[model samples]
Target: MSRRTLSILALSVICATPTLYAQEAGRIQAGQFDIIPSFESSMAYVGNVAYARDNDPKIYSWRAIFSPELIAATQVDGNPVQFGYRLERGVYFSSTPDDYTDHFLEASGEFELNSRHRVNALAQYEDGHEDRGTGFHWA
Candidate 1:
């Protein structure tokens, strides 16, 4: 199977695990703490403007995310988890006369584990890059 397919399958299994789903009402009502982590990466290109010629430059970025949920009987934490992936790529140009522009892409996915709880996973692929990387994430 392709890497994408395999990654998705693994995420599904982990997210759907009984341990993640079997949190009884009593547990939540009493009080509990949950922590989630995530990672993301993106790439893009830069170009020239009206007066200047084409100047192509590429950029890459990676980010880490952390979310904590606090639950109490009186004040419950709204939802349990939130997760997703985003991809962005664009071109820009600046010159003495004017400027130029381009476009990028984005995709995301998430799942809610009832009215007060949620889970999610996501991945994104861009157009141009030498090291194309995808992450396996869950929250």
Candidate 2:
């Protein structure tokens, strides 16, 4: 084929390529409820496991973390409401006594009595432990 014919064929093929779009695949609906679930995991090597300030022992260890979350939302009586739960777990290879897990729970609601007035409320609960020397922290 001639050079001009080859150029036209290449141009036509490029213009005819299809376009693609991406959509969220993690959302699910069940009986007036919207549920979304997600998870995250990580692993790291720590040269010093102890969060010491002075000349404390510098313990080397490997840490692994895993976190999972679930969210559910819906409309109740013309009001928007949502609930969520999350769990975080940590494991230490050398620092076995420092291994810990945490839990968090939360809920929120929004109400509109009229066009001129609105009300909202949120509640949260957390159960966890802080690092050494930081004192105990919980809510």
Candidate 3:
């Protein structure tokens, strides 16, 4: 399908879904921190399960994804701090070899350096992989 058509379809699906709020999605107050847990699951028809090369025959499949995440936020001496961890697992019905699992970790914070200037920093770590036959071989 054309990009434009896909974009429109995606938009339509999003609009048709009921509105959801973060507070309702997953929020828990713990002491001085808010611990939020979220889960996302989706099933889609994948056109290319193996991410086949141009010359290779196409391999189609059905893809199912399960993603879960946890976020903690609080204030340190009035400075905001946040940390999050997310895990994603994908399963392909027709192409079991294409299944994958990934992890992502993130943290950010703000510090008051005196009264006039403030410092903000963010750090992220990801353990992820691309589908077979995709991306370059750095080696």
- Expressed as tens digits, the lDDT of each residue in 6-122 for candidate 2 is 754553453344422222566788789888786766666877766655777777876766677888889999899999998988777668777789999999999999999999999
Best-to-worst TM-score order: 3, 2, 1
Output the worst ten-in-a-row residue range by lDDT, candidate 1: 93-102
Per-residue alpha-carbon lDDT of candidate 3 for residues 17-135, written as tens digits (9 for 90 to 100): 55433575467988998998876767678997776665979889767676778999999999999999999888776677888999999999999989899999999999998878777
What is the Å distance of residue 35 in model 2 from its true position? 1.5
What C-alpha lDDT, on a 0 to 100 scale, does residue 94 get in candidate 1?
19
Better of 1 and 3 by TM-score: 3
Preferred candidate (TM-score higher): 1 or 2: 2
Name the runs in model 1 displaced over 4 angstroms: 1-104, 115-117, 130-139
Reference-based lDDT, residue 32, model 1: 50
- Model 2 gets an lDDT of 0.75
The lDDT of each candidate is 0.32, 0.75, 0.80
User: Scored by Cα lDDT, where does model 1 land?
Assistant: 0.32
Lowest summed lDDT window (length 10), candidate 3: 12-21
The clash numbers for all candidates, in the given order, read 0, 0, 0
Top TM-score prediction, candidate number: 3
Clashes of 1: 0
Candidate 1 or 2, higher lDDT? 2
